[model samples]
Target: MAMFSTGGFAQHGKSKKVKNAPVFSQVVYQGDDKVYNEHPLKAGEFYNPILQGCYPDPAITRKGDDYFLVCSSFAMFPGVPIFHSKDLVNWTQIGHVLDRTSQLKVHDTGISAGVYAPAIKYNPNNDTFYMITTQFAGDFGNIIVKTKDPFKGWSDPVKLNFEGIDPSIFFDDDGKAYVVHNDAPNRGEALYEGHRVIKIWEYDVENDQVIAGTDRIIVNGGVDLAKKPIWIEAPHLYKKDGRYYLMCAEGGTGGWHSEVIFVSDTPKGPYKPAPSNPILSQRYLNPDRANKVDWAGHADLVETPDGKYYGVFLAIRPNEKGRVNMGRETFILPVDWSGEFPVFENGLIPMEPKLNMPEGVENKTGKEGYFPNGNFTFTENFTSPQLDYRWIGLRGPREEFASVLKEGGLQITPFPVTIKEVKPTSTLFHRQQHNNFSFTTTLKYVPKSEKDLAGITCAQSERFNYVFGVTKKDKDFYLVLERTERGTSRVLASTKVELKEPIRLQVKGIGDDYEFSYSTGGDRFVRLGGIVSGDILSTNVAGGFTGCLLGLYATSANDILVE
Candidate 1:
């Protein structure tokens, strides 16, 4: 994770070697000076999306020594998967607050609609953890749940009189609180488009009601800010040194179109954009190293206990075939101040994937497992006793997707579900470590009958992804790599590799590219293609927390033979 120099472009199979990485060696003296270095004055530990699979909009709150972060549970039963972190990195899934649809009855919610941007705020006054979300379909409403402890049962979710999506709550320096969100102006008013008038209003946290009426000032991204460039949505308010900053993402949440920062002095006012205004455009996500172009701008600010500020924005690491990202990933940057202004000294900076460790975690030594010869490795038994934060699921997660084998190896069952129907199921995964990194899995594939491909996927979304596996077409086995991008499939490579025995699959992913090969003998590796690279796309285009992921996937035209 430490860059010795701001280095080169590509360097062999290990493209994970970061390029042009700036070393803040001067930071050794700058903090005491008035003007800090523009880039990485003090880079906190880098945070990879641990809850990668569909965990979007991570609202993090710290209470005492415990840190709580939750993501939107879109259409998942256990709506909001709450996570606990300390030192703000290396998180483990504690539990989900909304477990039953009974308490969260969004029957009318679309296939992928349920909980929207939930701000987790712990009120120490009564020691109550308050969770609020935009209930998109049931009544198209705002709801609140209160619990003395998050791990315990939550009280009933009381719907607010508000109507909108991506709802967030801002509790001021004073005990005064307010719930702010953009309503579907397209639905209610003159039947205009949805991005028309995005406004902010006050709320009564005590009574779980709206203190301000529908007539609130349009903070940004209405006809006014909308004219600037990008669609203004997902607004959150923060007062830094008396400068009330209302920050929101624009240009929609997909592609490099996202404008990270547009600020305002008043919660509702002539909100101004940061000079670094289009604060975090993905124009810099190098096309060669990153497969997808660039994207992931929806963001919120988080300040550490040390009063250091950082913006948690999203980024996409593309896969091969150049499909856009399927999910958005959470990225961080340090903010330098120019008088009262919050400047993105490093927001647009391409974060190198280095390991800046948290202060408390005792272990920095990566766990060992099966790895070819590289910097990254995957163990049979996960080094982390629980689960690695690097892994994320579609929604929350379930134990059924996998379980720990008693023999000290991770025994993965064939989860036949695809990206569309996995339903937050446990399909343990890790972010692609490099624009190019090889992922190989040695397993025995026993077809239940025919038409089953069990293997690994450089998967972004159900539509935009690829997999390499063994399929029994007519009782004959063939090794194949199927590219599934935007609901279409083109076989990249297929061969009649008879299954006289079990085989191992290897995937070598380089900057925006990959190679899928099969090893029946399991001694040496073969090149499936001439170094197939992927696009820089990720699920962020599809909307979720995480970059493009190298996930283990298995599917069956019929049932699969367990091996």
Candidate 2:
């Protein structure tokens, strides 16, 4: 298997000045299988984020007792990660929808410029799962794929001629299927910056083609003509109590983000806005200084077996500077439907981390809780035949450059793609799930040239990153600490070291700061430099839709694809 890079970075013109922030780290999964807050498990109680770390735009569907869900992967190669849940609380990753390169084509994508929002739905009639998503700014526009067994593999993509982002498929009760998406306007000119319309098209799922003449606008701009919200996206269609409900995210995806509902008598007709418009939003709520789960919207609903309704939506946890480095994570909350429409809460949704699980659902997974119990540990021994499922690549697959050593450890071949470019960078990374954690890795190879380097990195994107690399200059070895804030990169510290011995690199994350250190042979690591502010790598600072990635990488400026 080859190595790959993951996560987005701060880009030009979109970069925000880094702010001085305090240290804060939320305890997620420890090393052991137990939640950090070890409250006794009950029948109707669980934590939020069934899936964690840059897992956004959650689309969940249930088949009998088994629940299957998926999330958007952006530029990551294995796009759309799918998970299985016996009860919505405990979820295990089954596989990826676009696991093979043939199913997905990604190359030289900018930060958050690949696959946008993915809608995964199961068709009971054919017993197959269909996943439709948009390849934003990619070679293909909208694409679809399916699989009988989600764990094994999915078929190649069926490219759709839809010109929009966040495409979703809705299979009506009458067996007719339709796709609702944020349709682009005509080519000439626009009155506003983000003026886009929502449209629905008659789709032929069996033949994997859309009917030509059946396209029509369902929503002109967005609800509340007075406010005139722009960027009406993340559209999902549903039927509730004989009324067709069309839910979409409006007012862009930042602070003003919100979920609005539209109801219509017919599947495709004049739709009216619900009285309780902007049903779920944190814009009015006080800034959550504690968890920072603000910017709540872009949701998908799923009804449980016991007739309980729950909505999985996207939310962010920002740092002290209001800069979100964790990206948009998936959050689940129960929907109370006692009134005319389904309500997530009485008013705007609250940051309810501890929620009551769906009724009649017991913990059948036999696990203690959703997260592990230790302080936060990810030690890849490199003993497995395949790389860990959590490991991700930049724009390509693991077969591109990195491989696991037979005896132990990992061997990352130096690729010609420099860390400066977003495309073709050779790196293998996992989500920096915890706010505070320590990452340590031992390097077995020595750099032969100034351009050839290998070590660990905490990256917001290819253009914005913090790298702790091993390098050589003038036949002397050195440990280097480099920081790439937006488009600017510079070395913070470097020291000469003996090249005969293996090197150990360490990066300790404390809230919005990262401390880098390294050792020559033993565990006697020395600090490389002062604490590096992490806000430079935040989505707010970096201006991307992804969180930070903690992983290993190797760079060869010569474009060589080998060691």
Candidate 3:
């Protein structure tokens, strides 16, 4: 993570505006094992972990009957995922910010460095909602964009002259606006890669600049009570009952460490820790008898029309030994203000799909989209924009790398010809199904050569992937599954392919690894690979800042791999 060094951050230029604003989408999941995260969702209770997956450092804003939210996308394209909710309880994803490569310099970014915590604030004076995200780990500082409709048109990122991580926006009751960013630039040179201590600086919205008010380091190093290392970032502020609070996430982002809260007051001095400072840690949840787990934390707080407060945070989920492909998903927790300080209660508000009358949204589950007869399609180039909020990449989504129909059906091209390139180019994936589910899809391929290939993968990591594809050999093709676990394909089976047919693949995720079955007839599938990507590969075990990603992939030849 690059820290803010000298004075002015980011190269300044005329801020252009992006046209289409992102949308809100709903994700519906089905299968058996009806235990909302091994537990049930009870209302009016502080539901812990409102979301379960990779939705980190949530910064949200409410407008009328609609609610808008954004999350940190480390390396995924379309950097920030924008979501909308009518009643806060139910959310739908509409679209993503930075719909192109020009919005980012992804190659320069590494794990967890693309987009950080964003502050979403609607400026009345400007009559626009500004979304500020930290790119390049605050080296180039923040990217500020604005819109009249959250679903479209944000002014191109106006590279504000400031550097810091975890930027936030605040609209004072007196109408004075300010931007609070995280970084202690004045505290000396790059120590511990500038992640040592983070502070906040106020910015002037009118001039599209940083104003000189108080850029103080309010909260010092966070609660390091987890017997492990700790750091603080993602700062959000709101004034209530004549008191100011700077709410933030503490501890590291994984394991039993992640949690959210604030220094009970101030722009400067005497800020006390929330009574429930580490209120909602999955580590604090009833530990498993086996005693093994990890949870992520980064959150945003919102208040409903009736004045009820809810916190949107992150947590991980398990499907037997296998974990979710989409890690750090957003979960809803209520602010337990019953005590002197605010705390997030426990619960996993099931992410609903559009096809199922919005389960949990309509308060009904066991019916539509849950039955085997129910229809669910992932046909090549299939899309449902209104239902994509459920889809999340483990890290940052740079540029406009993906789309549902946003680019016309999950348009995936090549970044590199092979995984060996480091940036596996043509990959557009969705979260692995969480329950006892089955996955099937038909793919049409045009592999120019054995080097140019496309395949169906149940991938946990580069080392652990079950690839079923048609590799061209002279003028013919073969059905293959390569398990590159031991530095090469340990399981390599290539069958002759009928040139005129499409490959139909089916994956049954039963106990442990998904069973891969293939067919040329498109009627019945024959087992091709067994138990590919065995388990979730162990947390932090895989390099990328994500869980296993399951979907389609393609690669060009090495010569075309680099552009």
Candidate 4:
């Protein structure tokens, strides 16, 4: 983990002007949510969202006493974040399944168009683990990766011949395998706007490909097509008591989202919709309920070693303005499978923030090596050579533009690309995990021109974001704030600054309101834009599948116009 800083800053002939790279000494993020403060966690109680902040479309699999879970990572480099846990409550991120650039080829794609709904399953037949997913970019649709050991690494992706999304692999008891995915109805036979079908194919596990001419339609148009369910996707297959079961997400991934189930006698057949469809949902609950959790669907079920069942699904917690800024997160609920169909216990009702811990399982979250859940504070001083897994780059590898300096700091070589472009920029990003939080960073940078800017950016996508940085205006230096919404850009505030030493920048989110401030060699921070609406950074307004990203941005092509 040696630093990558060697060449000095000098102008190359006919190339873009190179300025002194920005050095970020430290970054601090503190989460202080009121919901957690009011309804504090009691003994033997844990939070509903096991993993927060844009970790959606959860799929879990159990191998022996170890459980492995994965989630969708759209356009983020090192796609398909994989986590491991011994007890279902305590989890730790091992590493990404697609860490190499050869496996993740989303460098030219949009922020929301890469990996989607990754399914990780362990095949006891061969003592191997397979991760199947859809890459919306690079024309690499429906691919699978495998590894004998998930703790070490995974193999490069082998593209599967498929024309659909949300592909999952199921291993049968008879040493056979099948792939289930969501696709369009038969050619020209689509009846409604959201009409979709679930198709299954016999998979050749040895060769890692689907057998030709073996595809069959399993569930058409979701449960009860007469009612017209929209977006019947994220299908998973399981076998219990010698019966094959198919489960899917219906009614899109919004407020009407839900999980439905169907049963069949064989691997592929005329599957019968469960009489108790929508085994899990929160759509019918009161929207104004305190600490509300909505859009609960896209679930995958796993059995505990002690014969208990639990489901991992995606849900959201909107701010007071009814806007989704944190994006969809992962939540777990006990499943009651004593009946004909498994149902999420108390999932149909308004969800509570706390859940009773399993018998003899201590809540080790945020401690030892387990991933944190509740309120916490994280600080990074860039002293270590190895970057934490929490820091990620969009559409490209972080090592390409970022390097740890020998003098103990992070040096970001300014990329010619701006944040508004679909191309990968020199910005290190961390997901905005809480609605009420504060993020601050210490920066040592001085802009050479208006085209040179370095500071922080809160981005939802290429079209919607806020740029707050230090730039030179004529002969004077200034701190500027710019907001971009729906591809349009406007400056919110700008102030003159006398930069004699390293400055500090901070952004605080109070419910739906966000404040941007700066400090110059002092403890007092001056608010720049007063209190501005965080609507532009929300998925409701941004219209993407990602949460807000707090980015350490630097660009030689800075375009925030200042008057």
Candidate 5:
């Protein structure tokens, strides 16, 4: 949050006439080189949403002053994006943990049912980093992935038998390991809807298994056993001052989302709920919450080298009337433990735009971890040797199919179905970070058959998206546009086009409005269609837990004939 230098107020009374002066920008660039540049807040103040768009269920750990973070990527391949921060404010993506297809099995799964909360921790004793997550769709219940060097690569996976989701590992001071996860309700426990419990198991690291007969319910129901909370999941255990603290999110993932803490004297606990439950939440503080930020919970606390505590949580900045197009984002808040319990800044209120920076932290601009400053345009000229990590595919790794053409631009081979088929659909896309921005790409292809197609897509999920492509019907080529919402897709607009060269497709996002346009290697362009509510590409309308992924796509919806 940098502010530009400018004059204050000029006299404008009838006695003295004021002249219209040229307004100068008052924005300033701080940081190492000004890597992240945006003036939505005051100068010298940092903004919330450390990581933007669809980065939910944050899990963070600090090692020797270096902070590494991983978020729930759900169906997005190369899942569990790993980010590193020096000061905890400026973060840069080191790489992804699940970068290979063999490492994950998300094929044919819904966007919301793929990957759940992942926990990343470092065991200093063994000098190994472990990441554990749940694949809600596949047979793998809870898996652990370890790495010697996080930037280099990670092991395939060691599957752990767990009945529920959001599994996390914790090591005790005596070198003993334990796993805490949500325990699914059994047959007779039909007391309340979404009735779930948090349980712990002895983790045998060498054997890569949860010790049998050691399972016990630590915090049943929730902080308040009387209320019978639903979905008491995303459990994480932390130890400090000889007291084991379990942090978890309860009451679903929507407006009632909250972060609560329980304390126990032993690793296996008849844990006691903190007197002041919901250590961090913004679910009920704001009156005009529909238009502002809402739903903040699922937190992981990290103690900095300076002994200061900060918690990372997931929140959503609703664009309009409770429509969360950007999905859940990662936000950081200062945790002051000088009191009886941890109290977030502003004391259980909705997060503010500007927050106090960590002590002795320097603001670095144009840094690798921060967003690129100035322009918001991204173009793949295809001159580069390899595809950037920003481009991600459906369940499998994009490189297994998608390739860069020697001619120019990206080349995506056909899967079986278009965006209509949610699972196993071959597509590549990037998150739409800004509400008002333009995404354009040039497709270099000639339809071998009428089924050959490639173009731009704005996807909320596999079942819901807007694809603007150029398809061939026999000898003629036409601009094809289709919109799908909740498994229902209709061809909104299609027009003929004669192209002797590569055709450029563009999608402009203006708040809730989206306009599609195309051009054939010239300044003149044809408006395919527009005025489509961008909210239709939002999670609120699409009924999923993901944000809009707008990027290039090419699919052979029919099938490739095998020789």
Candidate 6:
């Protein structure tokens, strides 16, 4: 176990002075799911969701034998989590692509308003990797960053001359580069609510800019304009056997989501949609089917070293209550590119829980340094100089408020900002990885006033969340539980307590019910608010692109009443 202590202090807007700051000793997360426990992995089978828990909008690329994959991070600091895989089955998080505050400017934005649909591709012409995405906040619309070696560091963002989201770069075989993205129809060409178009521009490789006059519409209104398709985004241009292929995600990111393909003779194309249409989808399947996986789309394809093609896409697995709390996850499926256009092998049908591993590749997941799937447990002691990549902050970088104490443990300097505000708060967040899980942390501190509080926060966004912590009310110390749903906050429970030693706080989720508990000295914990509904922590109810976040939170502007 590690220990922490605070020495220096400062005052900020509307915050009161405090004597002792809160110190966190450790955090442990354990996943216990009935489905995963019953259905164990066989000899040659692996899990379907290679990268689980809120890792959405996957884009993949390969250079020689190495494959690099990236996912959308929204407003989480150090945006665009990147992963490395030798075999498509096993993956390891190398680090984030945007790891600096100068490169990521989402400081005052909402949790779900920063980065959207990041596309990563390798351009062999210059031996560099390009990551392009739209920053909905910070006024940095459609930016691109380059890195010669992804293991090192990335360049500062260069704003692109585009007006839309999901921008992707493609380097043709003849050394010419082109950029394709999702944009709205020209001026007044709107046919329906979700009517969108795919546009292409000739990119200048030397100047890193798209030619101003070379922009044109590639696929208008998706597969068939007559049907008026919705959200034709995440476009990628690929060339094989003297033909240019264009792929995109259609139908919104909801139940009707799917992947469609188009073909043309040139990069700038009057592209033709494939006759088979939806190359990948789970929309038409039975809703109550076993091991349900829905909302599958936003796919990127890559050819493995052995010439076998596979696609990394985003999908969701709802709980028994038919609610999505874990958010969209990264899933891999073998692609059958031997046909005219690439099609996800088992994509159209009801998705299975396991997939057959590639030839001669052993499943080293949950062992080695590879990312873990299925049921697993993660514990952090906060003793090392560098924090693990799994721990991240919201809106701003974690280093701005968190420090690993010289003597050990982690110290979070409380900010005046609370979790209810859109600004960055003094909180370190980790994604809620499982529906049935437990998160526990031990804290050592005593509140000086009612304005100070430190504990755990289970947040879906600023408007929908739960805060449970220790606060000073009147002349006594108390533990309080507050619930915020759709912007309305109310204290669910509160109890006076004596602060003589470190206290253990925990939150457990069993299906749609969530319970908060605490312990003072021993392992026995008393439940604080009984079982509360987790409906607000779900995307279906919270209305956002992100999943729930488990935050080690501390704030000087605490407002939960203890009456």
- In candidate 6 the C-alpha lDDT for residue 403 amounts to 70
lDDT of model number 6 = 0.89
For model 1, where is the 10-residue window of minimal lDDT?
Answer: 22-31
lDDT of 2 by residue, 1-563 (tens): 21212212101111221121100111112222133345454556665655566888889887888888889888886778887787787776655778766766676777578888899888876788889998764577898988887776788888898787898998887888899999766666345778788899999977987788899889877896556678899988988788898989998889999889899998786889889888888888777445546888899988887787888899876666677776888888778776767777633845755566665665433244233222345456665435546777878876556554445455666677766686756777777665666777777666777777777878888778887777777777677887777677778888888857567777877668778987776668799878889887688788888888876878776222221
Q: Tens digit of lDDT per residue, candidate 1, span 445-521? A: 55544545666666665456666666676656776666666666667666777555657677765444566777778
Query: How many clashes does the backbone of model 1 have?
Result: 46
Q: For residues 1-563, what per-residue lDDT tens digits would candidate 6 score against the true structure?
A: 11111111111111222348788889999998777888999998899899879999999999998999999999998799888888988888877888778888888888889999999999988899999999887879999999988777689998989898899999998899999999999999899999999999999989888999899999999999999899999999999899999999999999999999999998898899999989999999999999899999999999987888999999998989999999999999999999899989989999988899999999988777778889989888776656667778888877667776656667888999999999988999888888899999999888999999999999999999999999998889999999999999999999988888989999999979999999998999999989999999999999999988999999999988898
Error of model 2, residue 550, in angstroms: 1.3
lDDT of 3 at 383: 38
At residue 388, give the lDDT of candidate 5. Answer: 47
Prediction 6 TM-score vs. true: 0.96
* Per-model lDDT: 0.54, 0.72, 0.54, 0.89, 0.72, 0.89
Off by over 4 Å in 6: 1-19
Clashes of each: 46, 18, 54, 0, 18, 0
Give the per-residue lDDT of model 3 (tens digit) for 338-422. Answer: 5565676542222222111222354212123211111233323233332233333323231223334333333334444454333
User: For residues 1-563, could you state the per-residue lDDT of candidate 5 as single tens digits?
Assistant: 11111110101111111121111111111121012243343445676777766788899997897889999888888788888788887777766788767677888787777788999988776778889989876677789999877777789888787788889999776878999999776669757888888989998877767999899988778887688787899999988788888989988888888989888889899788889888887777755743266788888888888777888999887764467777898888888877656656663875666576676775553353354322244444544335445567777776554554434344455665677665655676777765566776666666656666667778988777888877777677788788877777778888888767767777876667788888886766678765687867887888778888875666666322211
TM-score of candidate 1 versus the correct structure, residues matched by position? 0.69
- Mind sharing the TM-score for model 2? 0.89
Q: TM-score per candidate, in order? A: 0.69, 0.89, 0.76, 0.96, 0.88, 0.96
- Model 1, residue 67: distance off in Å is 4.6
Model 4, span 1-563: residue lDDT tens = 11111121111111222258888899998888888898888899999899889898999999999999999999887688888898889988877888878899998988889999999999999999999999998879999999999987889989998899999999998999999999999999898999999999999998999999999998889898889889899999989899999989999999999999999889897799999888999999888899989999999999898888999999999999899999999999999999878999998999998999999989988878677877888788877666767788888887778877666788888889999999988999988989999999999998889999999999999999999999998999999999999999999999999877999999999889999999997789999989999998998999979999999999999988777
How high is the lDDT of residue 406 in model 3? Answer: 37
Candidate 2 accuracy as lDDT: 0.72
